[model samples]
Target: MYLKSIALVGFKSFGRKTELAFGSPIVAVVGPNGSGKSNVAEAFRFVLGEQSMKSMRSKRGEDLIWGGSPGLPRANRGAVRVVFDNADRLLDLDFKEVVIERVVYRDGQNEYLLNGTVVRLKDVIRLLAGANIGGSGYQIISQGEADRILNASPKERREMVEDALGLKLYQHKKAESERKLGETGVNIDKTKSLRRELAPHINFLRVQVEKIEKARELKEQLAAKLNEYLAREHAWISQEDARLSEEIRMHETELRKLSESVRAARGARGSSSDAALAGLQGKLAEREGKLAAARRESERLARELGRAEGALEANNVTVEAIVPVPHVRNFARELDATVSELERVDDIARVRSVLQDIRSRIKSFIEGLSGAAPVTNEEVKQQVKSLADSLARVREEETNLADELESLRKGIAEARESGFAAERDLVALEASVREAQSKLGGVRAARENIAEARRRFEEEVREGIALVGAAVHSWEKAEIPPGALSEERSVQEKRRRDIERLKIKIEESGSGSGEAVVKEFTQTKERDEFLAKELADLEASAASLKDIIAELEKTIDARFHEGLKLINEALKNFFTKLFGGGYVDIRFVASQEDTRIGGSLGRGARAYLYRTHFFDDAGESSALPRSRRDRRRAR
Candidate 1:
């Protein structure tokens, strides 16, 4: 590969755009002193990634720019571009032409471009190193630098010789490898530190995860126990409730039947006794009324008879003496008629009239008797006898009525007694009904108890479901031990207690936020693993770089020695032709003291040349004495 063209703008003496194209293998630029010929060479160095201002004959970036001269304004920036011909693929680029550009601003900032794309100085250097080209290499020789190889120190000469032999590429690779190794070591250290920082937190999260797992296990166990206990309790309560319901239904039915029987019995007793008593009481009342009437009639008749007897005793006259017999008989008959009419009359007025008629008749009879007739005492006696008989008959009628009333009262009393007996039987039946009702009440109360127990069981089931999730609904499918229902309530209660204890333990464990903790732990663990992997990779890369550096070192040393030998042979032939005499030898010598190179201390290779029998071979040919200047240069 060879430089095909160079373009410069505002670079030192080139204030305007300029381009130089080298089409042939040899090209020369001739100029007088004070012209800008050397500027072209420096421009090449500037474009090829030169970093030292002193090498470019400048103190800073701005010095590389044109300081305006004679009607020309100063340039603000300087730029140089070098194009390479890559037809032989000597440079690691795909194009037939490679252009490298560098620009310097007055602010001491520099920019690099590769193929017109912005890049870094390191990129340009690396790319150039691949083509065995560098800013400070033997590719460019200045006027005074023609003898610089002879005057340069052995170490400098060795570097120049290495550059000529294309060993600079290996040097660049070695340097780059060393730099990468150092950076990789730093990354490894950082990775280790990160892992160390993550350790404690990961451990803490692990503990929390373990606690969450334990709580989960306890919850599972609690759920199982709850299922068994609740299922059995529900079954038992259901059975008891059903049994109590049946008992209540039976007792209710029995009580209803008994009540009906008591009602029927009461109805029968009431119907019979009430009808009998009512009939007998009515007959007795009727008979008593009849007896009272008879008595009253008898008393009236006795009164009438006494009055008649009094009237007869007062009169004390024999009817025969007082009047004619027929007349007296007629008077007596009239008097008797008057007395019967008075007794039969219910109106006072008619009775009074009848009595007045009798009085008037008696008076008339007396008058008539005064004239002629007399009455018999037998008529009076007859009338009195009739009234007495009437009284006696009424008395007998009252006696018969009293007897009938007494009989009727006896029947009524018997009816009342029968009613009482019926009442007693009704009371007994009602008592039996009450007893049945009492039994039903007890059964109902038992049913209420069972219902309450069922309610409590349902509540427990809900609580279990809340605590242990929907697993509580699975109680129907739970495996129960044989005869579990036959066990005492205490056993079920114990199981319930176990469940409660486990629930409390689970509550105390945590709020189940361990999922988040576990997630975080997983992420942290993954990060740690990734970092560990990265550290391993970095370590591997550093090891590989070291191996590459070692290999490059070996190759560089071997190739450098080989090139040095070839250069020495060329030097011998050239020396003979140039000086027309003597012999020259070039060889490598190791320095006794360590030298600092590329930021590392190492033994340095110094090139030494010995010339004999030309002009200074005054004594026997011996190895050229080491000059103090050369030793100083080596140091």
Candidate 2:
């Protein structure tokens, strides 16, 4: 059988239903990472009964389920089902096709089904094994498993090749045969033990047969007594059951009447309930109206208070901005001094220029005296005098300029301080006005909030009033009241209790005073029946076991004879190949039990060897190795 198709539902990453079909001889699966292609291979393994979760790349069985992604909801369980085409009669039974399914739940539980009927994992494994198919079998080789044959030891490799040769059927049969042989041995031992145990009982029964015959008569007498007693008790129970049944009937009738009365009473009280509900509605409306009026009054008072505060804050700003006259006068004097100082600093530059010009003319006159010569004393002295006068005047002028520049700087510094203070006072006045305006805006907002709250309350009060009036009108039409229902329910409960008491009386009367005796008798009868059934089953098992033992003995004898026949034929072929001869030898040994005069069961072939000679190129006569006695003596 070959796999035809597999269907997956919520198994691994195949979140939705998916199906894969296989071609006759080859089916290739190719995919990128996480496309669930490997999961498809694993699905085959799962349905084939692979019990190792680790081999499947999962730490727990529930890991096989598809935990949904962000776009799809999670599934609670997973399923993988495989279909097989069995038309070639590869499987043990003849069927066109087979479908097997395996399901796993998040709770780490698994279920297996065959053709929609639940079955065990053992059944699935056996079915696949019959077809020479399994998780790691030759028919399905995964990419990584190719090296398994290379890595296997000699014995394991032999086993693998044997399985590929379709020897699994023979191996399974051999194992099953061995298991049956072992079980039969165990059963033989058990049966022998049972026979030993029954020996004393069998002997005892043989001795007690005569007494048992006498006891049978007494048993019949006891049975008659039991029947007589049971009949008397049955009559008393029947009479009691009848009386209780009649009382139960009377109670049932009364209960029905009381139930009808309750329905009528509840209908009559409907009008009163409606009226009471209407009054409550009216009261609720009145409270709502008072609440609305209070809110409106509070809002009006809030608005008036806000207006008054705004007017007061606005007037306060004007009074704070009035300045003192002395401050203004100080500012005017500082500005005047600054302008005068600016004029004095402008004249010192001209004086310094006249001094520099006088000095330069003196130096030019001295240098013009003569080409190679040192100056005469009188000329040198005259030049020195002119220079001294120019230098002395420049120094005096610079001293005067320095004193004037110092005074000007002092005046400018004082003016700057006064200007900064004036700027500060202006800024403070502007800030106070802004602060007052902010407070006025906030007060107005608060008043508006209160007015809105009052309006909402008024609307609710009007709606509540209308709701109460409508409810009152509805109540008048309803025709229902409350208390009558409670009274009628009490009467109904009494009738029900009466019915229950009558049922108890009927049941007790049937059971009667002889209940203890009857219970004991029934228990005894059940015990006897169980003992008899067990005895019958044990006798059947013992008989079947004898038949099985005889059959096994005959089969083993026949198989041993057949094995010797095959061994002889194989020996004949092997010898002819080794010896290059026309004649061959074959033999069968007598069974060990038949050779009771046992010397050491000697080592030699049972078949006597004989040789036939053939001619060489010249046709000469030749002698051949033959005769056990001649060969042994020569060695």
The prediction achieving the highest lDDT against the true structure is 1
How many residue pairs clash per model? 8, 7
Off by over 4 Å in 1: 10-15, 30-35, 58-78, 103-111, 116-123, 142-155, 220-495, 596-635
Task: Give stretches of model 2 more than 4 Å off.
Answer: 169-635
lDDT of 1 by residue, 1-635 (tens): 78789999999999999999999998998899878898998898888877888878889889999999887899999999888888898888899988889999999899999889999877778788777776555777776786765566555666777778887778887888888988898898899999899989888877887898798788789888888788888888877888888898889889989989998998898676788889888877766656665566557667766876786688797645544555555556666665655455544455446655655665565466446644557655664665566556557756876887788888888888888888888899999998998899898888888888988888988887777778888888876668876788898788878887887898899746367777888899899899989988998998899789879878987897788788778877887788676556665555544432543343244323332222323423433334566447646
Best TM-score goes to which candidate?
A: 1
RMSD to true structure for each model, in Å: 12.1, 54.0
